[model samples]
Target: MRMSMTDLEPSRVEPEERVVILDFGSQYGHLIARRVRELGVYSVVLPHHAPLAEILRHRPRGVILSGGPASVYEPGAPQCDPGLWQAGVPVLGICYGMQLMVHQLGGRVDRADHREYGPATLEVEEPGRLLAGLGPRVDVWMSHGDRVDALPPGFTVLARTAGSPYAAVEGGDGRWLGVQFHPEVAHTPRGREILANFLYRVCGCKGGWSMAEFVERAVPALRRQLAGARALCALSGGVDSAVAAALVHRAIGPRLICVFVDTGLLREGEVEEVRSIFTGLGMDLRVVDARDRFLAALDGLADPEAKRKAVGETFIRVFEEEARRLEAQVGAIPFLVQGTTYPDVIESGGGAAATIKSHHNVGGLPADLEFQLVEPLRDLFKDEVREVGRRLGLPPAIVDRQPFPGPGLAIRMIGPVTAERLQRLRACDRIVREEIRRAGLEDRLWQAFAVLTGTPTVGVMGDRRTYGEAVAVRAVTSDDGMTADWARLPYEVLDRIARRLANEVEGVNRVVYDVTSKPPATIEWE
Candidate 1:
């Protein structure tokens, strides 16, 4: 079970004392790590079966076992290192992680008669260290089919739900704790309290880490890695890339050349806006018009994955062309800098986790990319990246910009990408953002944009029966991009958006709002 260097690569900026989160294949594995980081004690995620040596390598103050979808009894199910229990570090097992811990110990776990899969009330029985501050009855999110039926020796029940008797348990030296429900999700209102208790009370973390410290550490690391080599940064004008560019520029200064490519899939006036923003910062910025190239690559591609790959490959090719052109001016650029964040990496199958979707930058890149990727912000979340941007003195407009997909409007279009469809989506997307901003909810919501469903609907426009494309508007609120809830914009604002789309934007008849959350549906329709 020993890991190679690549498999054990540090995903984020290395913190001196961190909580090591073992990913057991849950979609929320990274979410668990994010929650720990939000507590100001840095965390790193590793595979569930990572060896004990590897776990100790992180100098973990605490180890959190993330919930997974697999049954522990199933053959080939992921298993933890048996030595972990005796390793002396505090361990908190969650969901399947709890089941595994119980099963590994002398405890017995069996399938519950009724599976607890949603919001449930946790009644504190003993109110031990884990549930000490929370009141008797606490709300929690549960998604487990199997429950702990019998406790191992020295283990005591802390809390219980109707469906789960041994919902929360503590055992052995006051360090080992287990919870059947997830404490990382938004559903658990005081989940942060529980995690903070674990970090500060149990693990004794100082909670001293900050994004400013990350910038201080990252600049020195970047300078050391790049030495004097010139780098071409992929500037998407979004928060991640902008922060990454600023950090890299701080490290390498004039040697960092930012290349902003106009994919034509972007919203209206984005190219000019990005150009102005970076040029004003005095970074050597290069703007390339690759609209036709991107459109050609995306032509006839309806599958979301296909379109993402096409766009991704074309972006690398364009960057390569730009690098070649600049090679004569600035000799031999060897590094390609991108704003690839932790969510992008996890979603694109970066670690041992499953791939929900292939982000254009992470999964969509060509196999034969020549330049070495310098993702300064790869270990960061969206919020953390913004903090780093502020620490690096980036403009408010760039740092606070909403999350935009690397594939841009191409993925927003449901069908084949065309010049006409791009224009249509751009207009609709702008109006949705404008209305959201006008409602004074720009900074409140995570992202607000319009999706071209590409489904034709018949409606009366100016008393004429006209069949045009249907557009779906999506607005969401989220802490990190890991989980999101549809934003409930005021009715007045939604009405204005709908009316504007119907009258002002060309060839739009129907407007619909997406109410689905992140688990059932992603923020993006595609």
Candidate 2:
């Protein structure tokens, strides 16, 4: 739990040195911010209509306007602060953003005769500050229905494609730039370079921000906030919660109590595994067997969000009861520590990010919860958290553990959660995990688990045919949990998993592999 002073002093950057991304509800808005951080500069995503003063309060080095689904001429299309141009900061606009900027700056933008939807050849006519270093001819990804027809007072074309006359343009003082293509997507080969030019060449950023700097700032901040007070941590044995507990343990030492809730939704042997790991680290670990309570809370719930909220509410009640019991021994425990990551915050409807799903730790918590949450890793991605864990001196086994959702198998099951179904799914999950690791892919893949699809399938185990439940196996590869692709697991690995599920796991007569990725289907079945 103790960290060396050397690990705590890495020459951090001030939080004010960052780029502010004005989100126009583009699916790529969060990705834009991720790419900016990948370039070693901090960035944040705000709603398009954020107050001019609020956007400037960050002392942003630059501003980026994200593309949206709406057209610029639409009745109620999102708009940014007109004062942004007068803020004297560099700004880059993309897609619909470009059209909006052009329209608001006294330029004309109209629907194109033929909208560009995919790959296009960019013929760089000028290669101004934003497009500099990219070759004269580059392949870019474009998706838009409108194009700029006329230039604003001080604007000129920088590049053009077959579909649009002004694919890229620069205006007034070289501080305003616009591109009709999305630079944050992987489809654009040199997109990262374009973003780098804006961050470094245009905004003049120092590129000093990093995960190491984040840890240095967070440790002291947690200490100052929880000084002379006790905190309880929800230690779920996953990297997020484990790392969160480790950081809090470093800050408050023995005053930090780690609670492991056995909600009966966990995979087989997981409870034992967690107990061994943290207890060996000398943590103040306590286990609560709230299996019956969680099941009762989720008895009739078949909807994913409802089950999540039920489990979330049930979890808080258990923690509050435990907190009261511990008060007599430790005086008081007012804070609940969680390993909530950036993806969790955004997906839970934080700020301009859409609410894709309500994460158990983020959106699932009860409104009247007693403890204030201390989330040290709230703004970091999954990969960044592993780096922080390594910096905190945690072992590789804990640092590199694949992600597990907070709602656990409850979310993995496709229907009503029952004791029979829970055990069957747990066994199936163990087989999948075992086969994956036996193939030496446990570390290679982001997550590999089993889902109990409530639908039954006809199968034959002996001389006669039998109908039993089908189990779906899911495995994905991802850098951050925000985006993922179906892992191309070896056929042999897949075969072993399927065979084990059918032969060893009772009630699972058929097995299937899930090939859907994150965009269309999340990592978890729910």
Candidate 3:
């Protein structure tokens, strides 16, 4: 892929233009980063103990200390570089973070008389910089045992809850603030507003970063990196891959070959639909029908991780084969593009959590691969990817379709993946998709899929006893596929999906709706 002089121009950002969060291994560290991004300013998370020199290199406009489980007084607890506050950067601290600030700055902290776990009320003593526009009294999410007993020499009370006298405080320096409540999570009514106040007012950020700006930078960077080398993209037609492919295609033009891998486990007509969308938009497309290859490899692997690995390896093999075939025609395909997102990596053991499972691109790739991955959306979340897609002028239908796993229906098929089960699932899934679209709620959901539960249920079909597979319909609304809540689809829409699955699909005897959230149950059953 080659770019003209105009296309190759570099993108730049001024130092001191972004926010950074020092993660003390808080369960909510990523949430804090996401909240900052939602405010239209860039933010990043670093270990609480990250080098002050490294932190200063970003020339951050502001820094935030994420709440953690450790007590400030405990030995070996994560310690911040005291120079962080001394760096002349604005700082805000969350729950345990608040305690750490006070403890390190010469104030006392010990076990609280009454610990606040879930929710609490904060009464404002003074509307500090962080709490500028928020009213006198506001509800906040709190979870901590250690409380700040006294103010640091430069600190004064801003707000307090029943359990702690210094729930929120501001240092004599206008740049420092602390709150013993989680303002990152949605549970706090004015969490976003309070954070916005710190980000815009205290930090002096102009707040305009977005996925559009991201694409504007990425296209040029990819162009420079690839520098006329051939690229092969695994286009899954999902938001991530599509957006990734579109971005690379923009950078390299004809040098980018997009292959839509037909994993056979996909929903009915997905291959044709994807082909039409990309081809219509002028993408150089190659359709590989590898359904048999994928299904054969998934013969008896019941474990979800096994299935994910098998499918991921099979994907690499197919791409490697395609790369060899194209080698004679378009040089070497040095870079392989897959639309892998950050949350997927984090959930798959990239960030804080232990290994959940191998996200096909992150952990599931075969040890031997033909090309380096070009995942433009690796650091972005799902919603962010969608915005990038929209910026690239992809079809709304292609960009709006809720995400599907890279392993396809193999992961969605809980029991065993077979041609028969796949077909049955495809039929039920089609009904679910059609009904959701007909109800005009398709865009309202993050993802809605049909899963084939292993166990079969007995039912009387036209007076004859029949036993068939049970199916579960899952729909959720999530921002970045991080934390999700099950979509409260209208019962009338659910009724249509259930009725059609029971009558027309001919496979499912019972239909169940999954109401569980992500913590207890993932969006995909497998």
lDDT of 1 at 171: 94
Which candidate comes out best when scored by lDDT?
Answer: 1
Mind giving the per-residue lDDT tens digits that candidate 1 earns over 308-364?
999888998898888888889889887889999989988888667888899998888
lDDT of each: 0.88, 0.87, 0.84
The count of residue-pair clashes in candidate 3 stands at: 1
Q: Report the Cα lDDT for candidate 2.
A: 0.87
**Residue 142 lDDT, candidate 1, scale 0-100:** 92
Model 1 stretches astray by more than 4 angstroms: 1-12, 119-121, 125-128, 135-137
| Candidate numbers sorted by lDDT from highest down | 1, 2, 3
Model 3 agreement with the true structure over 436-505: per-residue lDDT tens digits: 8898888888889898888789988889998998899999988777778999999999998998999998
TM-score of each: 0.94, 0.95, 0.91
- On lDDT, the stronger of 1 and 3 is 1
Q: Give the runs in model 3 whose Cα sits over 4 Å from its true position.
A: 1-16, 70-76, 81-86, 106-108, 113-115
Candidate 1: residue pairs that collide: none
